[model samples]
Target: MNPSLRNALTRLAFMLVAAAAALPAAANIDIQHWVAPNGARVYFVESRVLPILDVQVDFDAGAARDPAGKSGVASMTQSLLDTGAGGLDEDTLAERFTDLGAQLGGVADNDRAGLSLRTLSSARERDGSLALLRTLLTQPEFPAAVLDREKARAISGLREADTKPDAIGSKRFARALYGDHPYGRTPTIESVTAISRDDLVAHYRTHYVASRAVVSIVGDVTREQAEAIAVQLTGDLPQGEPLAPIPAVTLPQASTENIAHPANQSHIFVGQPALQRGDLDFFPLQVGNYILGGGGFVSRLTKEVREKRGYAYSVYSYFNPQRQLGAFQIGLQTERSQAAAALKVVDETLAAFMAKGPTEDELRAAKRNLVDGFSLRLDSNRKLLDSLAVIGFYGLPLDWLKKFPERAEAVTAAQVKDAFQRRLSADNIVRVIVAGD
Candidate 1:
């Protein structure tokens, strides 16, 4: 399905690795929560460290929520939210933000869609930014012409991706793992082609409602101002109930899928359903994965597949914990001729690690790396704002950021082995290979 934690770890890995290689500070994140008048949940962090403000409005609408026959509706709705809203065209909205020195942007991922604003905390700039954001939220007009243009552009991009072996591998890997589930939904020429403006309007009406929203605020603002900002952002949206929960992920039975491609290198994906966000195994899996394949050049997989044997230049794995069970995935790009041998080594390496877990020294290094890098994740208010949005959307523990370090440190090697053995098995691992000789 969606490799949420994979994306998360890759981004965090960059920030975490570049931080000072010392012990992480004891984090003290004061997160506050409330409900706005319009039923939007609000998560606020009063930060006065800088004279700036960051606000994000998130809804439970994302790619996974797309209607059965319309895979791109949610993404299109989010992309068009600011194109023409409250009587302002896209260009006019851009100008308004520029004049206020505010950055207006958004993202639509597998589990959530959100818009964010960053601006100076001065009343003139902050108020203007919030006002503009409110307009985008409460009055998105999915202009038919704009929708048509974007659809054409998206089709072009999708078609281009269809030709690339790497793209095909990733998309098919999801299908191999989560067959018939919403998590595996990908934009096809047909699926995107079928999406009408009416589809966007309906998705916006149903999933962009106040009750499904999470208003996350960070940086220079009082609690009172934060509350008012949250209300202004969400108070006038359509009222709708929370969405029904997505179904649990069912792991694909073990099988190998080899597709012919002209590329000289094979793009391979090996994984299975493993863990969910906030699972008790989160720490063990997080720690153990670093020792297994997540620690960049120092990882076991990289050393075995790249450094030791020169079979590939890059190889890694991670646990992608989503709302339901996510995936533990190992990926590599190797020459077409070495595809079979590389895969054999990968299979043996995984089995050995699963059987024996990481050594004591490996476990210690994993904890140190994870703990030292934890602070980097919280180094900026923008990062913290993003974290708050994820927490609110997933209904995770409010103290998740605070507990990340200690929990990771507490994980024993046995715990890691137990967790991995219970969740992953050779019996269920799905393999996807593109471009084999």
Candidate 2:
């Protein structure tokens, strides 16, 4: 063979290998399910690859359920749920978990509150950890001392966050977009101080019903063991009234507010309340967003704001669909001097996309990338458990994950254009730029 031809063939072989390496491993997820006899929703995935059990219990008691004046109640309530429960005090609970070689964690977000346990699948470790969880869920003592300390900590954190420009922008943006809705409120120091032990108990009783809970278990656990675990965890909770349906989010009219913040860079966010979890437009909107801004370097916003003009270090956008309509936001940070220029480019890019949706090539690439990357989203038991929790919480179809790629592939250019046309209007977007001219 000629030397040049041989070198070219070697390069082609290397390229093919690289391309194959880049593709994600095929997804072979097998999700199983059964309702606990106590009425708790149970989602399980049995993976014997590792002798670890990752269990998570999610409740609908999130920040959105905070009372009008007590914007932080849900947050504080969740934080204290495991702090003191059953006959055990906070210190004893911590010591017991440590002795069992188990890890316990809790998360409180806008849409949900969750308690998670990670332990060895051995009987002693698993049973000990699960017993603690059962107490935390059904027998929280809500000790007065723990409540006072956590309240003080929460208040102090809120005070510190108040001084941050990004925090101010986020709170104001949520307020502006959600208006009088519960989603708009941010917890204040005053509200945190007002939260009493009784408040936590009441919130838990009302929202932590078995029917409203989803128990997700993944790892080396049998079907019988999973059912037994779910029953033990949720068996004693009072079967309260069904969760009050979350009302629709009415996106308030667009309005610009200039919050005075003494910061060197301006944080600008433009968007409105958008879709919910099960909305028909989710797939199209999600795929279109990757083309518009969610694709990092390949996104239109990054190309316009950073690559082309160098107005900001980073510019990005995403759609967050929660139980209620969450926001579809474009965010960027730039020096006060370049804020106006950056904002203009973001607006122009969004306007153009709204008028003429993603091109066929752009749509195809977005779908291809998203579909190919889907498996990675469920590669681990923790990831699978998280996805299952979301599915069970939102009443999404059991086949949502299996069907995700197909749906992305089926999203036509016309559907992407139509979904955006009906769901978002450029004229109705709220633009908030702090420290900008």
Candidate 3:
């Protein structure tokens, strides 16, 4: 086959895999898990539905792991992984993937950083992509010129964000809730400017080790092939010492900060640290939140704050469960003049929900909505790979996805109320309003 035509065909195959419909919920997702010889935790699900595979390797290296006074190191390190690795420059590395019909991406969040790949499962394409991925994981060049360029770009982006009212409100709200915890630390221009190449190399060496790696794989691969893939990917990783657990999140004293911004709308955030990832309270809190504010226009927050009073166009609440205690946040934007009234309604609604919990009808609806829609979460190989990564990284039960509906249905109104009351305290809640009257 002509080289160009062959490459185009391979790319089309990958696109077809991505566009394919979600595997049926009834399709057995038998997950196989093991630890590689070099200590990488691996979880895999095999599906013959497509001739493509998705792989994600997660590490305990995220923004929260940034060294003091260097808040953007982890993120910068992750981004620089593919820029130059194994003697390949940025453009060559990217073009190599293009020729193989594979996609490589990286993610950095509060608690984890990692690379993800999607490639055609044919032996040539799969082998070539995995080889590149292995090089990225083990031998990133962290080229000096690239580091200088990215640092400047990051600083520019941070400066731009500083001027936005929503961004100001978010940063203040994080600090108010998390106090001095790393979770509260946002990357400022100064912090990114201070991140030298040595900082990136050191952060990568400390955190990107075999022991901290979680390799999740999904799609058209056999168990034996998957095992070999895991070994090939992580076998060369540095055998660094175990990472120290992140510090616990200290709940903050209840306070409200009103920051002046020359914007027409007020951005508001409410609530406090409430749930950790994989907590027993996840279902109860999630179901209850749907009634409180997560159910879109049908939620009580929307009814009172947006529909009835027209104080805001949209309002919502959610419990973001991270490795440590994450925030239970209520967010909305409204006309500056109505910020106070909107906030008042949000607070009252939240207090009432915490006091009485979701109504029976609301609970049933929430469960139904979650349960009926659960299949959507698993419909794609990429989605399955994501869930597998969470399960592997967080040490959640292997059957977590399979049991979601059962657990969600089991949550009672009393459980929801008790969970909320125990987790959220009015005294420790933080509220930040930007551009409010």
The prediction achieving the highest lDDT against the true structure is 3
Weakest 10 consecutive residues of candidate 2 by summed lDDT: 19-28
Q: Model 3: which residue pairs collide? A: 22-379
Q: Model 2 misses residue 96 by how many Å?
A: 2.1
Runs of candidate 2 exceeding 4 Å displacement: 1-27
In candidate 1, what are the lDDT values of residues 164-232, reduced to their tens digit?
A: 999999999999999989888888989999999899988888998898899999888999999999889
* lDDT of candidate 2 over 300-333, digit per residue (tens): 9999999999998888899999989989999999
Between candidates 2 and 3, the one scoring higher on lDDT is: 3
Candidate 3 TM-score versus the reference: 0.97
lDDT of the candidates, in the order given: 0.88, 0.84, 0.90
Evaluated at residue 369, the lDDT of candidate 1 is: 95
What tens digits encode model 3's per-residue C-alpha lDDT throughout 320-397? 999999999999999999899899999999999889888899999999998898888887788888888999999999
* TM-score comparison, 1 vs 2, better candidate: 1
Q: Residue 416 lDDT in model 3? A: 92
- By the TM-score metric, which is better: model 1 or model 3? 3
